[model samples]
Target: MRLLLVTLVCLVGLAPALASDLLIVTEEFPPYNYQEDGKAKGMSVEVVEAVLDEIGEEAEFVFYPWARSYLTAQNRKNTLIFSIGRIPEREDLFDWVGVIAPFNTSFYKLASNGAIEIGTLDDAKHYSVGVSVKDVIYQYLKGQNFTNLKVVGEDILNIRKLAHGRLDLIAFDEASFAHRVAQEELEPLLFRQVYRLEDLSGDLYMAFNKDSDPDLVERFRSGLRTIKENGRYDEILMRYQLMN
Candidate 1:
């Protein structure tokens, strides 16, 4: 009984520390989240940092593959994943923080591939679609009942496959697709946006594990509101415009 009492006392004393500490996870999504010269640096990183600062909280960030990050955020206590789309399948899985960045997903085909055309979401069904494995786009397509999808580990691989004529259509977020194309010095005009997934067009958010303290999430939200009101949010966005 004495040992039990001591344990409870220790835990009570450690509660605030555990509540304020967080393990933030993110993927290498350029302009939003990525590594620069061996350091975690990006627009989302800056925004998250600013909000944590305002809320008097501290977090350590680690970059992981999206699938791993997503899984971790789903299962680990106090784990947060940033720049994730809040899809319906994930609606109640995590405590969502508001818009960290904008996301516009679309189906793209090689401009040279005049044979392929997608006028609507239904029209895309007949053709082969390339998607990143375990990505929100993949989930979205699966939800839409798309069967002819070639899932790759990296979205960049889909770009390569699309260019090589391995896919009839590829799904990608507009900003990320453009960034990757530019990174590879590929001609952007080579790809044409055949159709935009209107339903998938929404702002990305920072999401915490479902088991996280609700008060902590609210505090972060408050901090975010403060930053937006103070113009720091817009400032961060503008500072990263060059990357976008």
Candidate 2:
């Protein structure tokens, strides 16, 4: 009886460590994941939290700069990155689940500038364009030998540069750029989305480390599907004014 009791105690001690924990990485991209009122609140955060809740797991979110966050997700164990675009080069780097949102890459110009008519990527070849550094859209443009492109460290800077005439055009995710414009009161700058790159339509997903247990990834995926079906996911998105 004492031997059995000792064995039971050993099992109990091991149970908590055996339970899965999710490590999440995010950046300060508003309407997705950002801090407000001393809390991590956004459409992606709420949606990810709901999924974890449904799966009987908890998450620990580590906020970092965009580049650092991407690298952390790439190198760390049990870590997942949110709102990452599904790109061809990054397709196999991690286990993917939950295409949390879809956004379009667009070319924006000042409202008063009607002279610059950008109907396609090739049309803007002559003018200087700004995009976020290490962004998928920027990489795509670079690969096409688009010579007049500049990289900004952050998305907000790209918008500001365009507003200030430092750049002729800016390429960014539509939702993110719109949110920044609204928040920064840049409406007078005349933002026009000239071309929506269909190939660059970003499918945002929760990507876990490749070495992560497949069962855990599937659990999260199942939970995400459930939330989508039950309308919880949509409601969360609506709360953030993200869903159209």
Candidate 3:
């Protein structure tokens, strides 16, 4: 009887650890995952939490700067990064799941700046453009040898630089840019969507580390699918006003 009792205790003690473990890395980018009042709260956080709950999985998220988050995703075992742009160069680095949102990579110019007419990448070559440092967009532009491009450390500064006439153009995700503009009430910084680069349409996904357990990935995929099928996915998107 004592042996049976000991066995039961061991099983109970190990049950929690046996649950699927997920480590999430994120950055403070609004409308996605960001810190609010000292707590992590945003669309991506809520959606991921819901999915984990559905799968009966355990998850812990660490928010860092964009560069740090990206590095963490690349190096950490059993980890995932949220709302990462699905780029070809990064295709084989990690397992992908649940495309959360699609972003239009557009060029924004000052409303009064009539000299700039961006129909293609070449059209904006003469003007200095600002992009977020270490972002995929910056890498893409740099690869193309686009001259006169400036990279800022943070996304907010790109818009500010554009507003101050320090940058002739700015390349960024349209939804995120709009969210920042409205939230910050930057009405004077008139930005126009000059060129929509379909080639750079960013599809956001949850990227799991290459060394993560396959079962955990499968569970997350299943949970995501379940949420989408049951309309919880749409609800979460709507909750953040991301979906109309």
Candidate 4:
């Protein structure tokens, strides 16, 4: 009984360390989350940093391609990923921290293409659609049996392809599309959203690996809740002009 008690105490003491040290990872999904000047910066980054400040913690953030970040967050322990979709297929894969940003995906076509009129998701199927491989949009569309999907290594590439008329359409985040369009110095009239994927309209979330310390996850969750209630969340969003 004494040995059991000592072992229990030791395990309890180890829990905080198991969770406190985290490696935060994400892809270059701008406006929401991205790296600039070799440092993490964006709407979601500000939110995460605010939460950390509230919780009195710090962690290193690493940005990589979507697939690498996704796999690293999945295969490694004590990993947290942000601005990622909370899709059904990924439901049980991680310990979800909390929703961090708004995410709405839609099928976009060049405004110049007056010849294309998609009245339904099925109608858009006839055109070649660009999607980043392993991205939430790609996964969702592929699962929906979209046969014309043109997989790319990154969503930014999809933007360039669509701009060049290389793709008939592209699955893209609504807000990110506007941001990227402006970033590429392209006119907003160049493209328009033809179809909104209601199924993919869920907000993005921050999540720790399935095996991460639950206590640590709860701390971040609580910090997020506190910020939302205290107005810090809204302040950050307003600063970014992302309040919607």
Candidate 5:
């Protein structure tokens, strides 16, 4: 009878970790998480899949707008959102699995527009700065009280605006910006890096809802550690050509 009772308790304790019904949400952020050929593919997606496989779990991935995905992940239980910034404001909202990748953000300006010179963030604040709405870079600058700011819904819109002289400057992760420029056939040489926001630039992480099972989060962390230790993490980065 005692053995039966102990077995029940142990099973109850292991339920969370052994169960694998994780719902993963992401946005259409290229090279990280995006739809390719009617299927989900990207560096972040592959990383998440590898970690889940390592932990002997499966996740259902769905893409939505960044705002909708963020809200859904916040309110739903046992939900996960990836490639999200581990920013100060959102630190207490979710259980952080770990950093999946680094997102090096920087301010940029057109090289032809030599009229502006930005040595500091403050110097660039006077000009109209374009940023994707609800982006970490936008949130950071807004928190810093940047006055002349232009918020757009789409990230590529900012690049287009910057190219057309609608925005004096724009901010985005270096990889994303380069991809957008290449996709739009915009001259990469036209835009020059003004200032890299090292302090504000944060790593991308998978954040689980507050009500998520702690054991499940720990499983993901353990899997991530395994990949890093075995050098599979670096292999994924190289596969995406994200190494710098």
Candidate 6:
């Protein structure tokens, strides 16, 4: 009985350490959540980090491709995902912490490509469009029956494809286009937004796997609310120009 009691005490002591093992996961969706110089940095990342600090918690951020990050956050316990599009299709998949940033998705084309035009969503079907695999935009467009999509694992590829005239248009968020453009050394004036996906233009969020501890999730939610009240959240957004 004494041995069993000691074992129980040890397990109880380890609980706090285990609880702090939150895996912060995200993809390279810039100005919002991205990695730089081996450290996590960006608007949404800062917001999440502030929440962690406000609540006196710490975690490691892992950067992956969108599909891998999405899958890990969807199925792994204690994994927190950020800058994820909170769509109806994903409403019940995870326990949402709160909105962390505003997201704006759009279809962009080469400014010089005056020959191709998209008057309606359906008009985009007539030409080849490039999309990143498992991105929210790709999922939404795929559901809407867009067969002309050229799927790629990385969104940065789409930028090159459209630039080289291999794709008529590429779907991207406004911030991502600008970030990738600068990262790729492409001229910003060369691309233009042909259409804004107003439906996907909404709040990005941080969420935990559905099976996460209710208390932990609630604590994070409270931390987020506290930071927003204390103005840290707004400062991060203003820095990124995501003020909405």
Model 1: weakest 10-residue lDDT segment is 1-10
Task: Give the alpha carbon lDDT tens digit for every residue of 75-132 in model 6.
Answer: 7788888888887778899999999998788899999999888888998889899998
Poorly placed runs, candidate 1 (over 4 Å):
1-21, 241-244
Candidate 2 per-residue lDDT over residues 6-54, each given as its tens digit: 0111211111222345577777788787767556767887788888778
Give the better candidate number (1 or 3) by lDDT.
1
The Cα RMSD of model 6 versus the native structure comes to 8.1
Task: State every prediction's TM-score relative to the real structure.
Answer: 0.88, 0.85, 0.85, 0.89, 0.87, 0.90
Q: Taking the tens digit of each residue's C-alpha lDDT, what string does model 5 give over 1-244?
A: 0100001112111123224557787777887877766667788887888888788876667776676667777877888898899778788988999878767889999999988888877888889999877767888898888988898877888899999999999988888888889989988998998899986675788889999988998999999999989998889989888764
lDDT by residue (tens digit), candidate 1, 96-148: 88887777889999999888888889999999999977778999999999999
Backbone clashes in each candidate structure, one number apiece? 0, 1, 0, 0, 0, 0
Give the distance in Å from residue 94's predicted Cα in candidate 2 to where it truly belongs.
1.6
Cα lDDT for residue 217, model 2? 84
The CA lDDT at 35 in model 6 is 64
Output the lDDT of residue 107, model 6: 91
Model 5, backbone clash pairs (residues 3+ apart or across chains), number: 0
Q: Whole-model Cα lDDT per candidate?
A: 0.80, 0.75, 0.76, 0.82, 0.80, 0.82
